[model samples]
Target chain A: MSVTAPKGFKASGVAAGLKTSGNLDVALLLNDGPDATAAGVFTANRVKAAPVLWSQQVLKGRAVRAVVLNAGGANACTGPAGFQDTHRTAEHVAAKLGGMGPGQVAVCSTGLIGERLPMANLLSGVDSAVRKLERTGGDDAALAIMTTDTRPKTTVVEGDGWTVGGMAKGAGMLAPAMATMLCVITTDASAGGDALHEALTQACRVTFDRLDSDGCMSTNDTVLLLASGASGVEPTQEELTEAVTKACHDLAQQLLDDAEGHTKKITIEVVGAADEQDAVEVARSIARNNLVKCALFGNDPNWGRILAAVGTTSAQFESDELNVAINGVWVCRGGAAAEDRSKVDLSGENISIVVDLNAGKQTATVWTNDLSHAYVHENSAYSS
Target chain B: MSVTAPKGFKASGVAAGLKTSGNLDVALLLNDGPDATAAGVFTANRVKAAPVLWSQQVLKGRAVRAVVLNAGGANACTGPAGFQDTHRTAEHVAAKLGGMGPGQVAVCSTGLIGERLPMANLLSGVDSAVRKLERTGGDDAALAIMTTDTRPKTTVVEGDGWTVGGMAKGAGMLAPAMATMLCVITTDASAGGDALHEALTQACRVTFDRLDSDGCMSTNDTVLLLASGASGVEPTQEELTEAVTKACHDLAQQLLDDAEGHTKKITIEVVGAADEQDAVEVARSIARNNLVKCALFGNDPNWGRILAAVGTTSAQFESDELNVAINGVWVCRGGAAAEDRSKVDLSGENISIVVDLNAGKQTATVWTNDLSHAYVHENSAYSS
Candidate 1:
């Protein structure tokens, strides 16, 4: 099944006994003669899934017309058998696409790790999926990527001379330093595979890797962007870059907003840092902190924990170089709170923080959320 | 005031206007005689607090008569002002102790970081505390170190020759790798300062450092053990080591059990690793994963998340060398579960996980809990 969105990419989704819920588990996206230029991003985690391995290997110097993705069993850590499952899935897709080699088709799977695929059900599912492809089946492809995601995530953005569309699935947080999330973007722009690759990589770093609500990187995370040039409009480099970045930022935000049990989104802005890297190092560390997360939940405006969290990092801005702001109000400066904390409203469900390191000009903003009881409730409940 | 406990040491607790709660915030313990045989362990985070700075410099080559502690504000990141507060706090305590000098006392402050002390109230609290010294105020002193802790944490382990007493406070996991807690231990067993220091260091490794919960190390974290020699009998080297080790282990467990929002404790046992460190590295990486934490929260038995988490570490174990078990039940081996998840339950709040490296005999156990909504609620609602 396909996890891509491209013009002429007719897709179909079906439930073939892969998931116990009997929900749509197989999705196939097919491209006819005018195949869109393909660029994909796979998980950065060193331990790759079988399908991730297959896709990464396949996308090296070739363009693909289809992608096959299944939900229920992540073909990871299953050793040789896992690799075979990916190969077979690729072969099935390529064969269905008029005898192309398995190398032309990418595959992705997400679900319980360390499990084998029941070939009987999967093969039947693939056949059924291919037979029902349609030109406007973007909605069906979205259903195929669901694991624990409560809702299907899709985004369509229209830009000058082109349109950028995408979908992502991740119920929990993906660490900004490469999180656990599977994203697929389709753009009808006239660009070569290499250009799409560069755009996709650059876009993934700023868009997908900058979000760290829970700091959990999944093994099966993949983001594939297929540029089908079906729109017949050659967009400028600057416009393509901007459009890609904007879409990625939008998708990342949507994922954070829809993160399981997320009640409030907290923005951690690190300003005047020694560099963008250090600023990010400081802000993201605070974002991933469990105590800081809890404090946000309590809306206590416990700035002390924020300082403490920053102190934990290697970036040492002199104590005096540190200035902290909550929301739009400057609460702390020159190392301590600027005003009486009793007047600050830290109890709001939505929290914003800005920390300035009076050392440099580079700044970074990180999106996170307060850790809450509902988070525990949803996570501790039985698996679907 | 004093921060000591002796067979005959007197202690007192008083309110210092630092904490808005108006609860007991200052505590002092006095040995009353020559008790220079002391040892300490401090936070390894490099970013040291004022009291930690003072104590490390003073304790470098001197002995002390009392330990003075305040619970409201941590004099950290206050630039030169923070150091001044520590000096004044020590001086005030010394003055109240009649002929004692500032050098004869030690001070500890726990609460908001980057805040200045209310000098007037702090000095007054010291004076009042000195006048009300008694031998039974150890418990109250324990309460003074609390920040968001749900209870007073104090442990007294009576051994053959002396009593090893300790008090610690960390609602959010204290920093480990250095020390993630403020533990003041008092013992009557006779031992040299160097010997005591040696014992404390050796005992802390597996006990304190191994108990990595939230993995955030505080600037003010310290473990001070004082020997008053009130027992009149010097302990053997072996006996001293055993006592300190036991005390450290017991307190570490307590900290784990009291981890914030943790309804159940999960023990990750990574066995058969190539080496002990490899086993530990793999386990620690998993322990820090929020997705695994949430998965544990859900009781989903998503061993894939566990495998994915372990694989993220720098350990040398290959997928083939890895074997994972949860709650004494082997779920994933040779990279995948047995394809029978019917008995698996990811819905329970209390869960256990064990990962086997299957390559060597060395094993490491990491204690952690699932991330919960309560954790979020408390952190987000904290003071600004």
Candidate 2:
């Protein structure tokens, strides 16, 4: 029970004939509530999809009665027709629910870009999903948004008097799928629209934003948060943020674990930097280096490549004073060889690399995956 | 003849037992001239190799008598000891040449970093190379600096009365062989230290610097230009710069052709940009996208990935006005699907991609290699 775990929420998943595999490709989440407030974040990329543009317009009202998501067609780069498709879907969802308009609905789509959505099939699927909305339909809804995801991802966090639950789908980690990360988080906390927006912003900043699977930012990345005051328990904004962050963190980890072709989920931590920004910059540079990722894949303690990646960043650090540790073994100390590299064990699913700049007291951590032959093969095989 | 094609240069390559394969791994180039004025460019990476540091110091003196190169170890990140080893190598070369100080001899090494060079074998090899130095030894010198390189790269540009000859070795394109690009250029033109420095900078900026194979900047990238003033003709700086640029362009292209595991040489051109800087930045961002490279490897005209890469850059461009052409076929126009993508042919070894921002009148070009399975296999097999 992903989104339906929250109070006063119902969902359903239906087959829309959008996916050639005949899988469930359309999902709907409805808030039958006394209060409906929502917040959303989208991809920073300038080339956004049609659903993203429509949802951004919907979010300006700060109230969402329902969300409609589909897989198999991204509806991106399709010009004005794509936007019209997204708008018509929202209008259909609103008409299915009495006393609601298109402004109260948010839309999301994921699949191949430069393709038109099958509006007839999708609108009929929306009607069928509304007829089948139930509390137990969240699991199917989670599975419906999957493109190449091997498994559905869901998480729930229990607060003292409120609950936060979410579902996410993305498997482009080691596969050639479009890998458009889409997530819908629901809560029964008594919060206003402004408070919900603030909470969601703070939650995603440390969770979803820290992930760099392939360094490929998509044009259709979206995360939505909806709150219904059905619990009747008013909590502080900080408390709500804490619970939401926990749920998002758990879901993001699931995405990383299910990333395509990745064998090791490596975590890079940078410490002793001038500030948080510098630390994050340094960590991101190391996490994105293909050479370092390849070395990790080979289980090789090649600290020189890590330092070389760090040198490319403008982060504050003295080259001769840097230190790197692989899997808790300090292989490089003071920018030179230290412990015997052969002693380090890398035959595990998780690897940790720590870089100490010896500059100041600031730190950051980033998560990434190793590059493998499987990754190259999957990504180059076809256009996902 | 490579570097020795110039009028006042002598070169020799010798086996130093540094390479496990017992191949020629040491090279020497001597400016046996009445005048020896030189300039050099080192890697922009802050964590440079010891030899890069030594060579930068040699260039500060504005004159070079000889250069020693090895291909078994890159003395990088080894602390002060690595610097000492580089200094000792330069001193050995100076002593072998007679009547020269260590400051007049430059050192360049390319191989695995974080290791020490074998001083005993390397010093003996220096003596042997000096004894065997001849005007026709340039080919041997070019072949000596091979780590993963399949063949030596040599280029010569003939001016009205002067000549520029260069030799380069780099195979880090898809492998982990340090990818340290080293080039030694010799010119018989009459040029001073300042003129040579200016010319070398301009030539490298548009040639070697524009090639981003795998987007990994090495710690041991060095390009040295030596002028012996052997040709009595005094050409203007513009004339000398044109010749040097031609030679650098040829050598940079050769390096791309010989890049590891690459089947296609891709040229990404960004036109109608806001400025030259923006054009170059946009071209580089696209060239470095793993998804874009993988599509090229598969011979698929996936224009969405290209536009997604462009959206990530800070360059100024309207999303709806961007146009991309693959192999002269306008696959995407005004950010929407245009001509038939299937019509674009990518089966050839050379692929051209053009992006028109339609914003301004500036242009830039970047060359890169497609990411292939062989690249992943080669890079992840070992820590070369």
- Write the residue-wise lDDT of candidate 1 on B74-181 in tens digits: 787666778888998888788878666788688887876767888899899888888888878787787777777887777776768667777777766454764556
Instruction: Kindly provide the TM-score of model 1 when superposed on the true structure, using C-alpha atoms.
Output: 0.90
Every model: iRMSD: 2.7, 1.7
- State the displacement of the C-alpha of residue A362, model 2, in Å, after optimal TM-score superposition: 0.9
Q: Candidate 2 — number of clashing residue pairs?
A: 3
Candidate 2, B68-161: lDDT as tens digits: 9998888889899999999998987887689789999999998887888899999999999999999999999999988878899999999888
Each prediction's RMSD over C-alphas, in Å, is: 3.4, 2.3
Question: Cα deviation in Å at residue A61, candidate 2?
Answer: 2.1
Pick out the ten consecutive residues of candidate 1 chain A with the lowest summed lDDT.
Answer: A1-10
lDDT of 2 by residue, A106-175 (tens): 9999988777899999999999999989988899999899987889999989888878889998766221
**How do all models score by TM-score?**
0.90, 0.97
Instruction: Estimate, for each residue in A299-340, the C-alpha lDDT of model 1 and write its tens digit.
Output: 666677777788778774876667887767776787765766
> Which ten contiguous residues of candidate 2 chain A have the minimum total lDDT?
A171-180
Scored by TM-score, the top model is 2
